[model samples]
Target: MPRRLTRTLRRWLYIGHRWIGIITCLFFAMWFVSGVVMMYVAFPGLSEKERLAALPDMAWEKVRLSPDAAMAAAGAKTFPRDLRLQMLDDEPVYRLTGWDGQRQTISASDGHGIDGVTLDRALAVARHYPGAADVQSIEMVERDQWSVTARYDPFRPLYQIALNDAAGTRLYVSSRTGEIVLDTSATERVWNWLGSIPHWIYPTVLRKDNALWRQVILWLSGICLVVAVSGIWIGILRVRLRRRYSGGRVTPYRGWMAWHHVTGLFAGVFVLTWMFSGWLSVNPGEVFSSRGPSREMLQRYAGHDAPTVAAVVAVTPSSRAVEARFVWLGGAPLMLLANRQGRKLPSIP
Candidate 1:
């Protein structure tokens, strides 16, 4: 190749590489920072005392009911007005809250006079019921404090509910023991908002809505990959051309460019792999689909014995219900269960 043609090609490659880096810089920075925080932060859990303190503040004359009676009162409220009961710590204190509706606090121990109104009923009524609203379970961490969480159908617009109402107010509850740990409505509001800022960037936002912004990021990354690959090819062509003209003697400038070539040659493969993986993480279905095996298939592969197969299968009906079985495989107690299919599963050694 001629000197002028080589110079032109090099100039184009440099421009492409520089632009791609610049475009992805902001998204890359946000992803890096959020990933670091997620690695260290421990999410809060609930307490018992906090769960007990959430009883209704109504007068005895206005509401005179026991803990069981109060639960019955809340339960009778109807659809969109379904009463949710939660326990705090080991004590049986309940947080009475409405879904797609208002919430209240009631004593689970006595079911007496209303403890207090935690959420506004009118606002809860205005909210739409994307699906059935019912509390399946509640956990207590501290006295009068609890974490009340519920899950709706997958096709439902409402995904799940998590409340940490300890003071009978809007708070954050601990997942372990339905106890209020953080006053989320007050001082912690700013931090909660700040935590969500990273969702606007690359992989996070791409997963939610793959619009023009996401496509642009992908295109820029693809360009970078191509530039990296082209850099290696250019280096090889230069070496071959030099050897043809100069009888196999490589110049110092050619050597420096060769180093750049070799670096790009090796690094290009890893870089492409990273980009592709990142893309898959953002657009999962585009790369792979999920399909369940039939009962016959499972029996054929797993085992023909019904009792043996049932023993081997561990069904996690919900996130809260976890089943563990110990099997002595290779003289080691091997614990097995289905994993979050898409991600890498931990090694059992």
Candidate 2:
């Protein structure tokens, strides 16, 4: 190539490197810091153990309706996505979850449907927790700073109950089915201030709208990916390995520029992987499949043979269970008995 043309190309590459680095440096810094916090604290979510622990001991005597009866009450014409038999306010209840954000809770005694988390009902739920002897405050919310993610969208109009506990714990209950969707204590909130909240640029007003939150993250990550790639190229060129100074010194400049170059050398790969993976996380394309069975697969599994109310009215479980949930497999209702240890194999009908 001509010297003049080569000089012009180099100048443009330098411009690209300088501007892109300035544009993406802060986000890269945030990602590095927040990733460490995420490794330790994680985002606030309800673990299965915690959710089960929050409930009162199972009153087996309260379970009059069978698993099949619970499924029937939810109007499961073919097969439901998921079903759980739980105790709500000392009453045996069945929570039926289906695709496309469908949720229903039915009485396990007589199959009466229960809906919505009224303020009074929310207080009743708070009492189920051991530390929550008395409810201090109840906030009727659609979405907030804590519950800003799209995963919380299905459980709209959540009831955030502050339990009077040592940890200053808060429980978020779904108004749709009156189920405890998330639990957060003082420690989680303190750690997450440096974790998920800033890492994902998550805020109530922006994240409550699912479409916007996704777009923001997707586009931001895409831009950052470009910056990281360009930075790698510029670093490779600037790094000298032939001269005396080149053996030890990779960056020619000192101060912030050196900081940028040296840190970029060490951290550039992480920045690239994180940006690319973060974009991939949203899965702008159908690169990966979701864990749940597809609607068609579920329909096929329950094909021709529609589920009927099981004849077994009484259950004589061998082991003690904190709670029992039901699931449909091969068009038959299967009971999942769970205890403090974990869930046992689904009891065959």
Candidate 3:
């Protein structure tokens, strides 16, 4: 190649590499921080203590009442609304609220309650009761559950009450069995509530919908992947151009360019992998929900008949006992369960 053309190519490569690095630094940092947060802080789980503590300060009662009757009596007398009930481990407990809301523990043996707490009150207490600003309207759906769909003030975080009131005195009912599960405020689980911010990235005061933010992140990630690939190509081109320009004479940038070339070449694969995986992490339903392969396909990949598992746990009461299964793939255990719902239970055999 001509010397002028070779020099021009090198200049363009250097410029492209420099700008891509500069522009993507902030995004890379955000991704890194979010990833770390996700690793260290997991989604909320059932806390037996909190649930037990919320029960009315009554003595333990053991009765032979049906689950339906117990749930109905509890809901009508204590709760401000209807409740849901479920028989967990042969004991009927009010699933007043999900992991997302306050829940209750009812003694199945007797109608007496064991414990309960409102999720909103728990979150508020933990988060310093940062009262929502400008609650335009407060609409109560049930006793403990309400939806405040009004515009909140920019100074305060928008609060959604699935169970309990701001004062932490209301009782939330279970949707299934209609029992009063939690009787408290919305002032606990503050960290779990705050942790959702990165997933949405909406400021505490912002009222805008979160769809746009998610789209922006997805688009930026795609661009980053492209930039990473382009950087590798540019590095390769620089190496070739240098070799062609000074056939025998070692270029001044030999060491630096070599370092850049090797690093980019090796790291490109991992970076692209991370980019694609990260992108999927943000929008997993699009890829995993498609009907393409089956458990048989996975079994073939693993060279063994592996138990199929769902990626997410089903929210319904009946599917609570589901667990994930694993199969050996090239001597490494590959998790067959993709989501929390599909997590397998310990092998019975």
Per-model TM-score, in order, reads 0.36, 0.85, 0.43
Ranking by lDDT: 2, 3, 1
Cα error of candidate 3 at position 345, Å = 15
Instruction: Evaluate all candidate structures by whole-model CA lDDT and list the values in order.
Output: 0.38, 0.76, 0.44
Winning model by lDDT: 2
Off by over 4 Å in 3: 1-17, 33-65, 69-93, 96-208, 241-258, 290-349
Candidate 1 local Cα displacement, residue 233, angstroms: 3.6
lDDT of 3 by residue, 1-349 (tens): 5999989987876787678778886767666676666666643332334443333221112224443454454453322121333333234443332222334445546666655334333333222112322222122243211211121111122222333335443333333333323333444334334443454353433414346555776787878887788877765654553455464533235677656666777788888898888788777445557555654554456553322211222233332431222234543433321222323333221
Ranked by TM-score, the better of candidates 1 and 2 is 2
lDDT of 2 by residue, 22-93 (tens): 878788788789888989997788988888777766777888887578777777775466667767867878
Relative to the true structure, candidate 2 reaches a TM of 0.85
Q: List, in order, the clash count of every candidate structure.
A: 50, 0, 44
Whole-model lDDT, model 3: 0.44
